[model samples]
Target: MYKTIIAVGLGGFIGSVLRYLVSRLTAGVDFASLPLGTLTVNVLGCFVLGLLTGLFERTGNLSPEFRLLLTTGLCGGFTTFSTFMGENFSMARNGQFMLMAAYLIISLALGFVLFFAGYAFSAKIRL
Candidate 1:
């Protein structure tokens, strides 16, 4: 039990740092269109989650701590669903309704695609 807590905390910390780095690098990379930083992390996190889930499902013997660390800790901290919502809200409030809507559609659509791709790829690269 104690180990699980440590695993989750450590994983969360790493994931959060990685997320911050990604955000920093993508900060000024504006294509003058979408929130690329958040989109990138969210999609990447989703892909990783999907791949791990696939591998876990295939093995069915993953440690509980590892599972929590990867999913609850890493993915949770890495993906910014709250940030995504906030971005949408901010864009809408600032009267960028169309951009907000487009961002939502593109993010959701691409996220799903990348996640599926990762999962499918995992099936082929079984551990």
Candidate 2:
């Protein structure tokens, strides 16, 4: 357990640093009102996670620790959007269309609502 945590923590640190650098590099880039830096990171993270998932599924030789370090730590720190997309992909692949749609709708709606709720709450505090 401790070893797993350490592996994830180290990977998270590396991934976060990389993310910051990427963001800085693309700070001024934008397309169609979207932040290109974030779009790049999220798409890259999703591709990496998908590639790793396919390889792992094929090989099944990697240790759980390494997997966690890459997926749950690195990809997670880079962008949780990858995880969300990956989950939806998996559900679709498994033919769970209804559940996938529900998850997609609920997550997006509730996430936006919670984000604004938090923002409004913070603004109200004004401290």
Clashes per candidate, residues 3 or more apart or on different chains: 0, 0
lDDT of each: 0.91, 0.70
**lDDT tens digits, residue span 34-86, model 2:** 34555556656665666666556556678999999988889778865765677
TM-score quality measure for candidate 1: 0.94
With candidate 1 superimposed using the best TM-score fit, by how many Å does residue 108's alpha carbon deviate from the native? 0.7
Q: What is the lDDT of residue 105 in candidate 2?
A: 68
RMSD of each: 1.1, 17.3
lDDT of 2: 0.70
Q: Where in model 2 is the C-alpha error above 4 Å?
A: 80-127
State every prediction's TM-score relative to the real structure.
0.94, 0.61
Model 1's C-alpha root-mean-square deviation from the true structure amounts to 1.1
